[model samples]
Target: MSNQWQPHAAELAEGLSLIELSDGLGHLDLGDSEDVMVMGVCDDSRHAMPGYAMLCLPRSEGKATQFAESAKEQGAIAIISVGVSVDTDLPHLHLESIAEAGLLLRRMFKTEQASTHFYGITGTDGKTSVAWMLREALARYQSAPIWSSGTLGWMRSSNNICDIGNTTPSLLTMHAMLNAACQEGVHAVVSEISSHGIAQGRIAGLNFKTAIWTNMGHDHLQDHGGYEPYLATKAGFISDCAAHGGSVVANADHADIRERAPESTNWYGHGLDRDDVNLGWEQELPGLLRLSCAGEEVVIEDIPIGDFHAENVACVALTLMVSMGIELQALPELLTGITAPPGRMQDVAAGYGQVFIDYAHTPEALERCLKAARKLVRNRLIVVFGCGGERDREKRPQMGGIAAEFADAVWITSDNPRGELPAVIASEIEAGMAQPYRVELHLQLDREQAIAEAVEVLAEGDILVIAGKGHEAYMEVCGRRMPWSDAEVAERYLHRKHPGSGFDGERLCA
Candidate 1:
């Protein structure tokens, strides 16, 4: 972390009093004076600088006191922890709950009054897509600079980014990023709010400009203990947004979302029959999407094809217009500039047919992408996908059932079997496909081999859809992240089988 992000952190910390920070945490300060200034905030002792306050989260695994001692040795001025007590002479404070961390950190960073707007997106799918798409629109069209934090990383553009190795960053990291964005003159920040992030209090004390619900489905059930609880966690974020006066943009297509979203929501979806904005779109041609807002028809051309893509695009449009105050007349020029986040519905044209690589790990996402591929298929559509380990295990067979129902053939492969046997995960997936195979079913534990085998089966006018782990460059197996890329592997095998295949160099299309 190079002293945990250089002195930019120290710059935020400069002149911030430990007493004020303690009061923000609802703790009594033992500082010598209110002048006891903090130079930075850090969780890792390795990055502790002079006057830095070491923030120890509860998940630090009983090492908070040891880490605080080390940070004190490194010249840290203060310590903030939960339950753990530091023996050092530094001014130490405790948080009653982890949820207070975000508000306290925001106060410490002085970002509570920043002029920047925050748009938070959360749902089962399309979070990454909408986050990037909105950032693209705001960064290109709006005069003020924009940034997005999500699966692709914290980025202003495709090339310009800082990967902090998190989808929803921790409170310290999030406050630091927002502080940095404010320092950079950024006006809008688009962030994907995951279910884990919501439940874990990663975004506590955050006031959203708009809280967007893309759609919800069966994912992350294991973490929440059931689908009802998972839905509740997701819905609570949106409900909180409305309760706090933040604008809500909801996808009206999902009954779950529709039932949960507040009355003040501006909605978009193929199912919406609204008097304000009706966004039921049909593909006029391959890659052409026709969108309507408040009876004003506009066409968004040359985009990724699917109902899910349409849903994502519509969500972006609503956020732009309803929440962001963008005019309908500006829709065509603004919407056309947006692109799907990398590894989402990425396409490649081979000698036989097209090949698609997508981050469709959920059942709804997999079915949507496979159905989209079917639109481009003249003969057959085959899919290659798998679920992650240590996640919602119920979705394993559910995704398998979706694959069998949608694709003409299936290649079930390992995604990220972290600490779980890939073969065992595959067996659970296979249990979903109960009937004698309607088409051929290939179960290959080696993801690269599964992709290659799927590529070999492509025929003239046959589309190969590789789902799950779309833009990811590593496979997490047994707690180790091994280097891997589905796009690169598929491209290499596509070139081997069809010598004419090569990269389009834009979207990895070959």
Candidate 2:
């Protein structure tokens, strides 16, 4: 038989028996059932299996109850819970931590694999972009098939994509995706390595071929507990990759990355340090940067706006060169057709001022994006943005400070107010801005109205940045998601005035 299902699937098929388990006694009653094996334990609800188990306490609100109810309804046979002591009549497994469950599964499903090539990218911000570049380049170098599993989605092709519920899927799911790719003859698999993923050992069993670091900055302090711990988590990627016989592709431009550079024989550098790096870019336009790496140079081929992305592109190029052995000479020619990843720094042209949509939630990214937008604005830089609910609220003020310093005017609006009041979140942001900026601040809770106001106030040379949402199609408000698109609203406003003069159909506008 092909290595497809191998011995694990056979074992899973045969040993698929229902087991009732509980850690702490009496108070919690776990319902028992037959024919249900809770697929290892995981805290991430996105990776929870319907027929498996779920640990719900770590989440903010009713995540556990909601997930349990949903999973049971979807045919989940068992639940591994942490918080509620009273377990339902459903088959259940309770453990101190989900990690314990994961350990059990690994031991039970011991299937050995010969080879697996994982490309891991970690950074404070640009992890997704570097991963994307590496994925694209691998597809070019190896005529063999490839697939990408990240926050954006699983890209079977440039055109064919699937939703990725998590930035980093659980170990079991990661292996499953890789197994699927291998079954399909995939030669390369690029995955985004979040700090949490590295810290949690989600990518443990997988062997990596290359590790890329876009840059390091402040983020995930709440999860990591502090900045030092967060930095350590990011550092683990390079260390782990080296141990796995994979090369490190690091950005020499970043101070933190440079200081914590890992030891690797196949190390390649990328950034503004052209004196000792493999990749660098020349500023071509206000927001466009011409890329040059190895022996090739690709003119600004409609880059995803913002200056920070230039570094991201370089990191991707260098990773491709080191991992797949692709020459830089081929980049310029190949990049001629490449476009910006969905919402990294996508520019949407409006009739009056140009609108740029980006996924800049962090303070560093917000600062970089605002500065980049400022550079391109001849008249004024208008910003419409907000902070997400149930996230790192500490950065709210920092984000406001960055916008105040760069954007000529800003309209603070709601962005994924998951469970928090939009007005409350907006107020937190407003409190961070300087008093002088208050005059320029517009409080328009309706994102569409904010975009409309920005467009209406925009002149010919002005630039409008509609940020925080980026490529997402829905707006999460008060525990529910509403179908909304900043790009759509901007385009509608544009079309209402100029019919075909927007970036709606064209990749880039003149």
Question: On a 0 to 100 scale, what is the lDDT of residue 505 in model 1?
Answer: 29
lDDT of 1 by residue, 372-432 (tens): 8877789888888888998888888888888888788898889999988888899899889
Q: Specify the highest-lDDT model's number.
A: 1
- Backbone clashes (count) for model 1: 0
Candidate 1 residue pairs in backbone clash: none
TM-score for predicted model 1 compared with the true structure:
0.92
Predicted candidate 2 versus true structure: per-residue lDDT over 219-286, tens digit per residue: 77888888888888888778877876779888776677777777563333433346566567666565
Model 1 Cα shift for residue 444 (angstroms): 1.6
Candidate 2 lDDT trough over 10 residues, lowest sum: 2-11
